[model samples]
Target: MKIKNITTFLLKVPLGDQRFYSSQCAFPERNSLLVRIETDTGICGWGESGQYGPGEPVATFIETVLKPRLIGKNPLDINVLWEDMFTGIRDFGRKTTGIEAMSGIDIALWDIAGKFYDKPVYELLGGAFRKKVLGYATGCYYRGEDVLDYKKSLQNLKDEASGYIDAGFTALKIKVGLLHVKEEMERIAAIREAVGNDIILMVDANHAYNFHTAKRIGKFLEEMNVHFFEEPVVPENIHGYKTLRETLNLAIAAGENEFTRFGYLELLKNECLDIIQPNIGCAGGFTEAKRIEALASAYHVQVIPHCWGSGIALAAALQYCATIAPSPHTAFECAPENSPMIEYDKNVNPLRDSLLTETFNVNDGFVQIPDGPGLGVEINMSVLKKHLTKT
Candidate 1:
């Protein structure tokens, strides 16, 4: 079937009281750009671009540039379409907004392909390696008042860790690098005390530290038995990543900011990271994510996707996660320690819950893969309208 039209929705959800701080910025609101592609055959699919950059640029790029090329093309030829878009923008749009726009359109095209074949996206990606994947609760962001009272912030973090455990999450990731090294260590200590030893704990610095600072923190994390340390240094510092991985006992994870297979190849060839976190929505969708996964597999690096945004992004991640083969496969690959995991942002976002007709809920530390066709989740148009903003 031929493509008919494409629609883009720029959504913003105010965080108000839920405002939290990462290492680099404060998240006062969550924003997403959703793309809907309708075909002449009456089939439609939904996708989301990454929230890394401004939504308006991504929406505009999709409509003004990519949409024209895809107007009457066959959505089933996803790879060819992806190549065409990627090549057209290779000069100016390789990294951020250009690829991000392509990501949304690529995901929607995959959704259309799956529906056409009467198969799930995972099956289209070469079938499921596992039906469900362990999910880690990604929260413990710094509060506005966190710097004012150290003791109170520590207590707040402890309480938050306990709440995630109560909510059936066995794995948790906390934010760091916003505070002094000593203060952030105390926060980690508090959460570790609250969750105890059995729970899996990870920390994301969000590229806040320099090489020396990250080294100091990495030593402490190794002692704490933290599962992974994410983005300790800036993404540009390939040498820092290599040295950190060599020095630390913990896994060094990054790549959420990375663009495509070409970008990922640099990290892999350098032996920089022990684990690579590629956001499907941002890192070229399923088409390029598959390539990233293969490239990571060759380097023996784990590929655990970084997921944030609305349910459309989450569902796309879940579908992609289903196809990831066990890294360093063993008979017990089904175990959490051996298998890959998906990041489940625990922060408040109505877009994640109310945007889809059937919301995804974590159960016993795992989220079942979506089984319906395409991304396997239906959008609630009313919720879309509620959060829609001018582009």
Candidate 2:
């Protein structure tokens, strides 16, 4: 079937009391750009763009630019369509809104192809390497009002950590780099004590530190047995990543900020990271993400995708994760450290929880990959309209 029309929805939900802070900035509300592609034969697919910035620009780019070229094309020609979209913005749009828009369209196209073939998106990708994947709760952000009150913030963080454990999550990731190194250490210490040694702990600095500071924090993380340190330095600092990987005992993970296979090739070539965290919504969707995964495999690096958007993005990530095999196959049972894991954002996001007809819930630290056609989760259009942002 040929493509018919495309529509865009910009959804925003205020966090009100749930407002929290990462090292870089405060998240007062969650924003998402949902792209709906309808084919002439009456089949439709949904995809989400990265919420890194305002959704208006990406939506406008999709409508005024990409949509016009894709209307009469075959949805199954994903690589050709992706190339056409990429070449048009190759010089200026390699990283930001340009690729982000392409990502949404590409994912929608994959969804359409899956429905047409009567298979799930993972089957279209290849086949499932696994039917379920491990999940790590991504939360424990600094409370907006409690940022300055170290004691209150520390207590809040500990409580949050405990709550995740109670909710059946064995792996947890917390935000660092917002407080002083000493204060952050205290918070980590408190969390470690609260969760005990069995829990798998990780930390993200969100590029808040320089080389020296990251080294210092990395040392502490090593002592605490943290699984990985994410975005310790900025994405542009390849040398910083390499040095951090060489010096630290824990894994250095970065790439949610990276674009496609080309950008990922640089990181793999430099041996900068032990793990690459590409967000499916931002990294050119499954078409490019599969390429990135292949490149990472060639370099003997782990691929654990980053997921922080709506349920559509989460479902897309789950499908992608299902196809990722262990970096190096072994006869031994797969350990938690060696197995593939997907980020399950535990932050307050109504769009993530309620936007889908079937919400993805983690059961005992693992999530079942959707087995139905396409991304497998249908959009709740009523919920979509409720949070629709006119812009």
What local distance difference test score does each model get?
Answer: 0.91, 0.90
For 132-152, candidate 2 gives per-residue lDDT tens digits of 888889988888566767776
Worst 10 residues of 1 by lDDT: 144-153
The CA lDDT at 189 in model 1 is 88
- Give candidate 1's error at residue 117 in angstroms: 1.5
Candidate 1 residues 130-229, lDDT tens each? 8889999999888755554667777777898999999999999998998899988888988999999999999999999999999998899988999999
Q: In model 2, where do residues sit more than 4 Å from their true spots? A: 332-335
What lDDT, from 0 to 1, does candidate 2 have?
A: 0.90
In model 2, the clashing pairs are none
Off by over 4 Å in 1: 144-148, 334-336
Query: Cα lDDT for residue 6, model 1?
Result: 94
